[model samples]
Target: MTSVVITGKRYLTKPEEAEKFGPFERTYLAEGDSWMDSSAWNQGSLPEFLVRGFNRRGRSRLIVNISTSGHTLTKIVDMMNDELVWWLNQGTYDALLFSAGGNDFIDAARDAPPGQGLLFDMRGKPMPANGYDCVNPAALQRLVDYLNVNFAAIYQAVRSSGKNAATPIYLNAYDTPQARDAPAIRDLAGPWLYTAYTKNGIDPALWDQLTAGIFKDILHTITAWADGRSGVHVVPTSDLLDKAVPGSTGDSKDWVNEIHPNKSGWKKQVEAWLPLLS
Candidate 1:
């Protein structure tokens, strides 16, 4: 495995404020969720696994993992500041792995009461349920536009960074989630799409596709932007984790929460991504 630090930074507001995950910095920096991971999963990530497999034979890699739960593109771009740029200029890094943007729309999909937040489809007509109003499809469109530019901006910033020039960059495209949760509270990463559908008057049968469709749409937009960048690679894992294997929870082995993968799920991700890094 290559030497690196994983530090997390995020932007949550409109003017977007960049906040460091911690006080210290390392060589390998990480951002994003369950896949990138949280305390609950308590497993390892692709980057960690990669190092254990390869870097163990020699000097250990310096890693900085600063991922936050429910990270959005807005939060990521805001984190690019003089501090990180200075660190990049000073350090020697082999690669940077990134996963983001799902939380953007995942945040939008919930509580869109048919007559409320996102009440209509693109046609400017009221949605079938919960209520009615102008179509909020524009919400997704606007997000697409924002991410298209920002994703590239983040990539370019990494490429132009001091010691990071020519460094390989890896991005993960998560497998589509079950897209349905038991509808928890706001701000918590549980179920929102299921609540949206049940509340929006959408047909129950269409719920799964509806949720998956939004995820796919945003993911496609993200992939298109990353398709042929110089050293950037997007790893896809939807098929591995996007199945229905409910237990005490109505989810799969691949997932622990709404968007994060469990240990088995991360292993699957590593399997797909190791070859790319090698």
Candidate 2:
């Protein structure tokens, strides 16, 4: 139960460090965005929680994490050409864990040029029935389709690798977040959802409904893609944790910021995902 997680750099520079823990029952190669990468704002992320949980269960697990904060799915795919391939081919990993799509959705929420972003300019449009109408259907579809293609590419890459051809691939969908002014770092990083909703002229009342609807669509689409696929698991996390209070500007309930969860929230999520890993 002395198992631990290490960064890809550590694994590369000191391969014997993992051996000190010795005789791990399961090893995982993980790559993703901020959810897997702990920063100054977030002390422990999903990968770290998974290691702790596995140790608690008396299962020895070592995770080689190669995730970077702020990376989009496109960037994740681009990484395949570099160090990701080396890890995939060199290790006898039990599974490949990925945490993505959140940043991609965040990027799409930007008010980019016409037809480039997910939100519609709701300025002069008639009032809609619900918050779902805040998002442009075609643009949303394009984002989902783009994510699907990239995920499929990652899947294919793992399958094509002779060493991990049969390794399980696990993906996690983010939980719904409140559209507020809570940034991981004040004035530096985010308040991502708040900016998007405000820029699109979406009413404050509709922010919660709209954010939930968007994540619901993403979860459903990703789950559908993984359906009937061999060795692919989509860990549904949309409703796992309590959402942040609507107008709070800092840590509230289970959320640390606009996107990331607090340690308690990560614990709940990891509990749900542990059975799948087992």
Candidate 3:
């Protein structure tokens, strides 16, 4: 891949303030669990797989990543209609990638725990600091409804806006982290947000329960709604993390923070995307 450039409406908060896995700059849609603090996927960090694409000895491919942190559905549509049109006019990119929805889910999770801290291990059992509400089905359902509607709109916008419908658009699924060792992360405001997966005090079994089955449902739901478009590819992280084999404690593939990928995990992310790119 060649140099990447993202163009879109920018957000007002600091990038570091996001709890999702992304490293996105201004306006990004949070779709899944891993998208919670996407600092690693921002313009600067460039997920390792994209780097590999850059290094390949083939026709040059440019990644034009136009995203911002904390972008909502209405904001995203406005940006695509306005700022993104400007970027396309500038003649950039060999391929385009889009992500969003995680923030909405995060918002949903918030409603579930309304005014309470998420203080349990991934297993949903009480932890040292365990005393908060967690994600209830009702909140998740609302977010899912929102994602289905907006995702289609986003796809239609990109496809109809003179960009090639066949332009290898890649979307991603969430990596549901094992929940056993999670802690409640309180924001600068006095609210109890979900905890980040820390390495210091993780219970392996709890992680297994947290990650097991939940992500599959998320992926399946999205894919069902997506209708298997040729231009879209959904990277399956549940399979990727299978190398860690949730139930087994001997897996060395665990990341330092029980949530974010380590070097090996990053490699797995790249591997998942490679097939789609080709």
Candidate 4:
């Protein structure tokens, strides 16, 4: 099989090592660069699935992974336009695996505590701390509308770049995170919803319902977007990971924080993607 053209952020980032497969085992899909030494990437590591699955398949495939951590969808597409495609030649790869939009939704952390307005408002910012418990259809419509627009542009860019129109672009819905975080890890750089729920004293059941509700909306929107679109497939992943229950938290070790999954957690997600990867 030809090398797969991978790009996006966080969940799709390339680990410096691919374990049994190793970075050296996979040729660099970029031009003029024969190999991507371990030193090339600063932080994010290669996703475990690609490494384990590729090795098991006994295929010598090159992976041009260009994903990063904590990046928004816009930033990912920007990189694809400016840097990634420069490394590509027409028909050089078989597919593109993209993981994004989750960062966009989680970006609410930057807006301070959202008080207690049903968590995410689809606006990606702290909604009015007004303590509302209902979804705002109009505002959500606006947000999802814009989200689709951005996704459309990203798809257009991918299709036009290096004549990659026919390559499949894999996508997925994000998993729900626990409403917990501690000061120890990353300076409590967060379980994302902690500030919002803690600040306003949101009811556990409501919080769970709201969080799950928002993700459900996101999943549906993406599912619709890729519905009839050729070469674009939505890889179901929300089911792969566990969600935080009202009175209890998911296995703490399952996540690094908020949304980033721990090694084992990621491995589970990778298992879900194995069918496509293989």
Candidate 5:
């Protein structure tokens, strides 16, 4: 059996997710040539924290990272097809750390024309204000549904393969970054997301719906749905907020963005997965 880190997008920002739980009885994945000198170690980049296990199990750890930026299940399968096939037949994974779904949310919300409505993104794309009806809510919902279907399909594929069908899978849910970063909203030059979206023009109600309602609900639903599966568990990233007071200065520093976690943030999330880690 092998230890593996199966993830996508922000989840696999680094190998620490798989290595933190190790003493390397027999680690598997290959390390990047400049692994020790990767840029993610820099501040403002991913934090230099443990992946998941720290004071728990210290054995031969093999981390096989199958993470990709902006990847959906369809995209990840295409990119890692050969690697996944080999890993499946080789039966090299015993413990697994799986995280995903952020890109699906990002894609659903990205269709908004630049500058119109509440812009919750930092990507340097052009902004435009299309009217309240300008955003297609139904299409977005359909996109989300499609994403969930793909997620289920991927999970089924993994379970039906030569690998252990009962191998525990953890579904990670993101916290409300906007709500979590409220202090930044109060101090930042503009209303952060709100100002950015209406920098062009958008309705106040629409902004609230986008930031407080839709964004949070998307994450909640994904986790709730994933949890219903027999062999899957939900691990929420918001548990750290237990320590982050409502009006604290450190909130901004806690997040890399609305979804991705900083090193310390990721550490907190990984903690929730420890019991599930086989």
Candidate 6:
């Protein structure tokens, strides 16, 4: 058993390439955000770790990955219509692995005009009862609705395609990440959560609590939607890795940056999916 990775375009153009690494047991179509496309950072990612895990177990697999970094769920939906649908129409796959929604939440945390964005500007307001007050409830509901609609669209598109109508779809619930100043690469990519917290005047003491509550809402929304949906599996990964320390600016515990997990972290996360995929 062995595993191979190829771009969606390459897979479409040179279908024979995958066979070169086969006598494989299964093939997968994967797409989404940085968690699936962090090769440039040289940090291990979910897709990469899953491949290694399968290989070690003597299960041959081919992953046709079309993921891009920093893409939101909306963008992923557009990409599915643009080209991914072609793959679905032309090929047969055992599963479709998706990793998104994280960036959508991050984007909502960006600084925006008053009454916009997910985090309420706590400045000039009286102290709230708890971290949940730090969020804008209306905005959060809108985001949840938008994500659900898009996910449903993706599911329908796949089901409409005859080739993969019965192929199982797998989505991962991302682990909770500490809101901090850590960036994937200095002066380049991020410090996303920290900036949002600071600009919104959120107390540093509430960062951990706020982030955890927010992710819990998101995970519950998605998991509930996936419930009873045929061929859809949400891999529970929120508890797989140690959360990054609250105020640290760089790698700490299982995290390599503010958002992505290190190699060992990703390996542990992949363990939850192994039994499901097998």
Going through the candidates in the order shown, the clash numbers are 27, 0, 34, 5, 13, 0
In candidate 3 the C-alpha lDDT for residue 128 amounts to 34
2 or 5, greater by TM-score = 2
- Give lDDT tens digits, candidate 3, residues 40-150: 342122233454454463423333344554555445665665665555444423345554554454344333332232212235444533222223455456557767777
User: Model 6: per-residue lDDT, tens digit, 27-77?
Assistant: 888888888873555666777888899889988888888888888889988
Q: Write one digit per residue (lDDT tens) for candidate 2, span 3-118.
A: 68889998889978987897888899889998888554454689888888988888888889999988888998997879778888787899988888888888898647433489
Which residue ranges in model 4 land beyond 4 Å of their true spot?
1-46, 78-80, 88-91, 108-134, 182-184, 199-201, 244-253
lDDT of each: 0.58, 0.84, 0.43, 0.54, 0.45, 0.84
Extract clashing residue pairs from model 2.
none
- The superposed Cα distance between candidate 5 and the true structure at residue 220, in angstroms, equals 3.4
Q: Candidates 3 and 4: which is better by TM-score?
A: 4
Angstrom error at residue 271, model 5: 2.4
Q: Name the 10 consecutive residues with the lowest summed lDDT in model 2.
A: 110-119
Superior candidate under lDDT, 2 versus 4: 2
Q: 107-132, model 1: which lDDT tens digit per residue? A: 56555546455434323433444222
What is every candidate's alpha-carbon RMSD to the true fold? 7.5, 1.7, 9.2, 7.2, 8.3, 1.7
Superposed model 5: Cα runs more than 4 Å off: 1-39, 43-52, 55-60, 111-136, 179-200, 203-209, 224-228, 242-251
- All candidates: TM-score: 0.72, 0.94, 0.60, 0.71, 0.61, 0.94
Model 3 clashes, total count: 34
Off by over 4 Å in 6: 12-18
Residue 15, model 4: Cα distance from true site in angstroms:
15
The reply for model 3, stretches above 4 Å from the true place, is: 1-48, 56-59, 69-75, 88-94, 111-135, 180-193, 196-213, 228-230, 242-259
